[model samples]
Target chain A: MELLLTYDVSTTTPAGRNRLRRVAKLCEGYGMRVQKSVFEIVCTEPELLTLIDKVQRIIDHDEDSIRIYRVPKGSFRTVRMFGTAKPLPHDDALIL
Target chain B: MELLLTYDVSTTTPAGRNRLRRVAKLCEGYGMRVQKSVFEIVCTEPELLTLIDKVQRIIDHDEDSIRIYRVPKGSFRTVRMFGTAKPLPHDDALIL
Candidate 1:
């Protein structure tokens, strides 16, 4: 399944980059970084659950932060093109 | 850019659904739900960062449990077809 995960960083600080990089490493093979603080990961129910657990550990923010919205499978196309009128070549390659 | 986001729910409980729904509503137009607990949202840097802040407000989990990986653009196709050999039509429409 396609997943859209977005996070809010404290700042453009080294700590933030380190945190994001760590997340990238853990999500290796299962996710792709579409933006600086956004990621897309694919996995089944069990695997997805496991990854979420890992994410919780990865971002140890004391203040409640980090929001994830689970969009239905085909919804990516509409959402991706919402703001941008033209289709992006990079996203076209994301087609299954 | 394309984004894939995955989340972990406590259970298939009412609260979980409500939480997910809240997130869905907040992320409306920018994300799609590809799975029960996973979604794909597309947004720019500022928008994504803002969304993350809203997420924290929706899911008030004392224990950290949401992990987000920001995959670079064009990485979704590779990861989507990783385990499944055959391509799914639903995802195809997701192409930009």
Candidate 2:
């Protein structure tokens, strides 16, 4: 499945900054960064569960928001991108 | 239907800034702003189509990306929000 992951992490304190970095790193491991705080992840069911679990653990439930949108494979056809950023290369094979 | 709208508008030029403002204004009409560039919208099928059409016209298709995710009504139960932002109030009666 293809997933669009977007998050907002509070950065009012040093701990919050750390959590932000932690969340970004965890997301990077599972997918490619599409923007500062957005990622496009292509993963299987198990991988998706693991990624969500790891992110949930790192973020403070009271101060952060992480939204995962499950998109059907090949649905990028409807995704429109203009300017410098290109759409996620959906044609690439998933190693998993 | 409920929609999650997210967009990234290029601001490298004066015209781009204008586009950003226009896009923001268009979105504000159809939903509540969740963040700088995110919104939670509650609308009917026709409203959704109208919103998308207006947005697509205001944006520079080559320089902006707008994504709309459709979520079933009452599905917000899975939405998790931490920190200062609260989840979109799902119980409010839709005047439409």
How many clashes show up in model 2?
5
Residues A2-91, model 2: lDDT tens digits: 776777665658987798788777876666666656677778889888887888788887777777766556645565443444666545
What does candidate 1 score on TM?
A: 0.41
| Candidate 2 ranges with C-alpha deviation above 4 Å | A10-18, A82-85, A91-96, B9-25, B43-65, B70-77, B80-86, B90-96
lDDT of 2 by residue, B1-96 (tens): 666677766565888779877877777666666665666777887887787778878887776777766654554555544444466654553423
Fraction of the reference Cα-Cα interface contacts (below 8 Å) that each candidate reproduces: 0.00, 0.26
Model 2 interface DockQ: 0.31
**Candidate 1 Cα misplacement greater than 4 A, ranges:** A1-96, B81-96
Candidate 1 lDDT for residue B84: 13
- Highest-DockQ candidate: 2
Interface RMSD of each: 13.6, 3.8
> What is the Cα-based lDDT of residue A47 in candidate 2?
88
Q: How do the residues A4-83 of candidate 1 rate in per-residue lDDT, one tens digit apiece?
A: 55554443467766766876666654655544445555656777777767777767465214554454564544442211
